[model samples]
Target: MTLSFSPSRPAYLGVVRVSAWYDLVVTAGFATPWSYALLHGGLSSVGDALGLGVLPALDPIQTLYANLMGSVVVVWALLRLVRPLAVHGLFDGAARSLFAMWQAYALAHGAMKLLWVFLAVEVGFGLAQLLPWWPSRSNEVEPALQGR
Candidate 1:
């Protein structure tokens, strides 16, 4: 149970890329207002069908926030997807941790149970990227810059 906080491990690059790909795939639909509207409708239908309450109709502010978040995430995802570095895993992991925290808070406050699906994925990816994939060795770890 030795935790390697070192993001300089080469193996971490794979984790970064995978996380980025997940973001791209999942959030792409939210990147634009039009697309988000469509996605919201689709999600609402799915939720209703599953007996989970539908997503609330997006107000202007909610739409704006969703679009902004999606845009930023898509760009960030593209960076790692194209040129993943070990350090990217560290930052992505941190971001996932924050997202999971907020999602949990929302769930606790009575947000959609469907969110649990997202939370699970977030936790999975966050832990995968944050945890040490291999045993740490001071003698073996590369310099931070070298990991780039």
Candidate 2:
């Protein structure tokens, strides 16, 4: 059997939901001061174990920024998790693209290699959600019936 690259709405929405879950799992710790303290230690340990340099000691300003970012992202993720709409995928993909770009910039400016892991995920999900999905035959049938 041949693999099909045709866009499937159900599959696309599934990807959106999966991406949302990933964000929730990864960033939930950053959404609150208490959780971020624990997360900071965990991440620092992982970095040291992987031979990446340890993360710097957490500062109040840094924690504040992290919390703000986490709060926004968690809300966005929840929206996608609840609705899993194609439009949500589009917006999420755009945000992921931006995040990946910033991650790359930080890496270039001496950010830890550990960030590469997050960057890879951001790029993967961004592409999966943002790739063009136009129908091959607009006149043939309704989109819902076209198996798209």
Best by lDDT: 1
TM-score of each: 0.86, 0.85
TM-score: model 1 vs. ground truth: 0.86
lDDT of 1: 0.81
Each prediction's number of clashing residue pairs: 0, 2
Please provide, for model 2 over 67-146, each residue's C-alpha lDDT reduced to its tens digit, 9 standing for 90 to 100. 99999999999998986666677678889999999999988988878999999999999988777343343332244333
Give candidate 1's error at residue 124 in angstroms: 0.4
TM-score of 2: 0.85
lDDT digits (tens) for residues 1-148 of candidate 1: 3334546655667778878888999999999999999999998888888877688878999999999999999999999988887767767878999999999999898887788899999999988876653345443345543663
